[model samples]
Target: MKCNKFLKGISLSVVWITLSICSVSANENAAEVWRFGLEEIEGSVQDIYAQAFKRKIEDKSQGEIVVEIYSYGMLGESEDLTNLTANGTLQLTHASVGILGAQIPEAQVFTIPYLFSNNDDHNQAVLANNPAIYEILGNALIDQDLRLMTLYLEGDMVWSTNKLIRKPSDFAQFKMRVMNSSLVIKTFELLGATAIPMPYSQVYGSLQAHIVNGQTNPIFSIEEMKFYEVTEYLIWAGQQKFTTSVLANQAWYLALPAPHKLILNETIEELTPYIFEQQIALNNTQLAAIKKSKPSMALIRLTKKEQALFKTISTPIRQQFIQNSGQPGQRLLEALDKALATEK
Candidate 1:
């Protein structure tokens, strides 16, 4: 009886040790989740691209890495998410170049008017395939504790107003909502408008309340935000072209294993073309749909000469951006121009 009791105790001890070992191994093999944040609504281009990224990462990583997305300001607004990404609290985020400029001013290079004639031109000039321009912009935020993963041209920006704005003087005395960007603000002011900087989330209510008479954004944004509801005119002024970037927390990205980093970079390169195509398609479709659905709303397109006049008016603003952007900003602008020239 004594021998049997002693053996039973030993067996129980062995079982406990085995269970502990298994627990440790299981913890070691568990996947690491990379969280992504998007300020846009679900089914929006931002959300769609994010979901695709999450899927690609998971499938390519074979369950070793998991990508979790928080869309529609789930994690936070652009500013909050930018802080989270910089401080390494969040793994990744997507934001407009203008929004990212608040964190890394060098990103404003893309806001230069006529940087590309259209989305296709912008894609060909500054996408993952073109390392010359891509690397400069991508690495611009490394010092800010964030790293740019990729860039997509959102679309051409247009002015939507309650009053028709056919010329630069037409913008005078009118309140125009703009992103919290000095370059954008300066652009509106140069065109003779009162530039009111506001967060995108507040734009609709502000329009309703007449806090601002008008705002500028891509066709997709104008439609998505339903600006036509409160406004009477959509002006295709093509004042500024908008581009957005995917950014990763520098610390988190640097800490990734070599294989993991390879997987991420490859996945981004593979998926960039699709995202760009989708953006172009959505912009075209929404532009047409908005015009159709809001037939009562005026859809105004400036003649080439008229657009040239606006560009001439904006030259000073461009200079202001270059001067304010500092030496690196100058270099980036030059590099971008060089790339564009080469493409031409």
Candidate 2:
């Protein structure tokens, strides 16, 4: 009889332990889940960052907050995702700062040609050392129902084309695909190229069909889009560098539990430096890989004189951005100038 009683006791203990584990899992399931939308394909830098963000946030929060990333237009295109994120319909998104200008015009400053001397200046201004620039930019977005997180370093924008483009005059009459930003369109127009505004999804097809003669994108994106498959040249004019950002729905972000908010802010702080460094390294790797794989794709490094000609032609467009960005823009520009000067 005592043996049977001992067996029953063991079974009861097992049931209690199983119930306790179930209860803990149920509590974890109850934690809030935020959906992060990204347009980059799997293995791209943007997608890599999204995965890192999700991992760090969930790990730090101990599952009290969950981040689920939907990539490769799984959510929508960049413009659509930005709008959804702005209205709280979507929780988060990653995009170039220029794309947010429609919601906050001051963001256009980042898209201006030759904005940063190189990646290090851009990194300091956006992430490491410049609080003045961040404050001005963050203030501009606070009222727009979006929150600016940090400026991500991608790479300098390079022009890829089928024709050799070593000088400013060579750009004349070339049809180039540009983003929806007016500043980008004007930049290409100033170069004497016809700027065709097209969604990123269509870039490959457009290039294949020769719908546009070429497009401008980061060297990484040029590889991601496989533009070299159809095109034969890469122009290193150093005219513009791309700066992406992490933008959240202000309403959703502000209402997050204080602890959860702290986790996210902390995650950004930890990840920014790593991302800045990784992107610079990745740009070099991807550029080399593309060139080795596709020997037909040639590179044109513009002479200082060639870059000078571009700067001279694009001066009016840059001035217009400053004049039109308002006082906030002026302040941000001055702050960026200070940052760049100090870094140099």
Candidate 3:
């Protein structure tokens, strides 16, 4: 009996040791693989953020966490990536507010044209200091099972067309490809273009086949998408600005070890400005490159008066957006206005 008791005690000790080892191994494995997705082409803003994220996470985690980036719709389209992240199929993703807004209506506030008079105002409204703004926007995302990691600027929207767009009248009858955002569609409609909502991947084919005569994007996207090849005109309208939100699957993020979660949040905080600066630098370079490569492409430079005229025409569209988006839209506009007022 004494011998059997001793043997049982030894067996229990061994089992406990094995279980502890298994727990440690599981945690180590969890820290090793961090997967992320982006819809942008490689080297674009999305790509830049993904690369920055990988570098920072790996450096901070000391190789304990490795980040894998999938770009150019590798895992799926923009909408698919958004849904996957929401459902925890993907760990992380970067999506334009326009796409994310479709899932969380409150996000539409970022899509409001001219709501931000310039880049400085937009940045001020969304940063960490603005708790009211962040709280509202962040909660909207949280409700959708996504955590808003960071808001990164994608620059102002500009026009690209096979025909010149020097004036509002120039866009008349032009079939312009726009994201499937109601505000975007309304904005283009106000500008006199036949706004055709399509995915970014479809823009190229539509332009190539003359199914769409024009599209709008920041200059970096024009270069990245090779819009110059399909279009003969580039316009610097700066009609609207856009920002992308880096999001993580809330469940997946919460599942991470405390240290790993801290590392991810810290890495994103460090990477936001870095990625935005890179985007600005790239946009400048792309603008120069596009000018050099397609010298014949007409460049439409709008005068202040003409831009004002365009804004005047877009007022009703803005009103419609606010009305359609309801109280959430009002709250966003109020927050933006408050941010802008502080600048003065």
Candidate 4:
């Protein structure tokens, strides 16, 4: 019975039960076991990516590599999971950018509102495998003993509040829930709101109890977590999205054989497009589900002029991100600008 928690989505084949077994290899090299942790539950984009990677690596290595997945709370929360991975207890984890930003401030560069464009392909190239992102930010993370892999673009962050948030002024009366990041706190403050920093797991209950008047998350997350049930309006701010990261333990990654590393990198390359497609589909489906379930909940898609109002105020947040990120932040910012510009 306890094993059910450990193997909730071993293959994610069965609805409630999973039956997966790595084959007994006849290869000379012993099989390597990797523990991968996710920030979302099974069937979410992160889990879908992890499962795909697991299947690919096991097949590519001829069973030389076996990836074991721990869905969300199965192991622990973001901070605990990331700590375990860094300490070599786990090989990999999908961590929230806000949590990662606390230790490696350069990561906070992503907290800057309206950093990425509306173009999906443009965002994907810069985020998924761009040297500008991984090479610049990745090099910095190595000093902290963690290897930055790739960024997962879940969807545009939409706000769920009992009232409409049509402009920055609307935020003044709301206590906005944000991740535990200084940049995020300041971002909300600059937008004229009282930011309540908390863990992701607490958002739903906080909204239900009126502890937090509003929260921002991708539509899929809001619908999946049932945040819509307690909130009255879904406002698409289009300022920031859920851009989490995949990371590996530096020591563990560096110690891996060249062949093993090759497999890991190649698998991630293939997982990128696949996961991106999944995120888009999942968000679209979930948004419809939320609308169907909460017929009275108003959906506010901010006009271009309205979005520009918030985007303009977000400029100071970028400067603050650079200050928080230090020297690398400048280079990282420049690199991102260059990448995005070139994409245009």
Write one digit per residue (lDDT tens) for candidate 4, span 131-212.
Answer: 7678778886777677888887888889889888888888876898988889989989999999999878888899989999
Regions of candidate 2 where Cα sits further than 4 Å from its true position: 1-29, 119-122, 125-129
- Please write out the lDDT profile of model 2 over residues 85-160, one tens digit for every residue: 6655458888677676755678888887876765464554455447765687888776667788877768888989
For each candidate in the order shown, give its overall lDDT on alpha carbons. 0.76, 0.77, 0.76, 0.81
What C-alpha lDDT does candidate 1 achieve relative to the native structure?
A: 0.76
Tens digits of per-residue lDDT, candidate 1, 175-285, equal 999888878777778889999998788999999999999998888888888987889998887666777778898888989999999999998887777877887898889
Assess every candidate by TM-score: 0.86, 0.88, 0.87, 0.89
How do all the candidates rank in terms of TM-score, highest first?
4, 2, 3, 1
lDDT of 2: 0.77
Top candidate (TM-score): 4
Write down the worst ten-residue block by lDDT for model 4. Answer: 13-22
What candidate 3 gets wrong by more than 4 Å, as runs, is 1-31, 119-129, 342-344
Candidate 4 RMSD to the real structure: 6.8
| Candidate 4 ranges beyond 4 A from true positions | 1-30, 342-344
Clash list (residue pairs), candidate 1: none
What's the true lDDT of residue 46 in model 1? 87
Best of the candidates, lDDT? 4
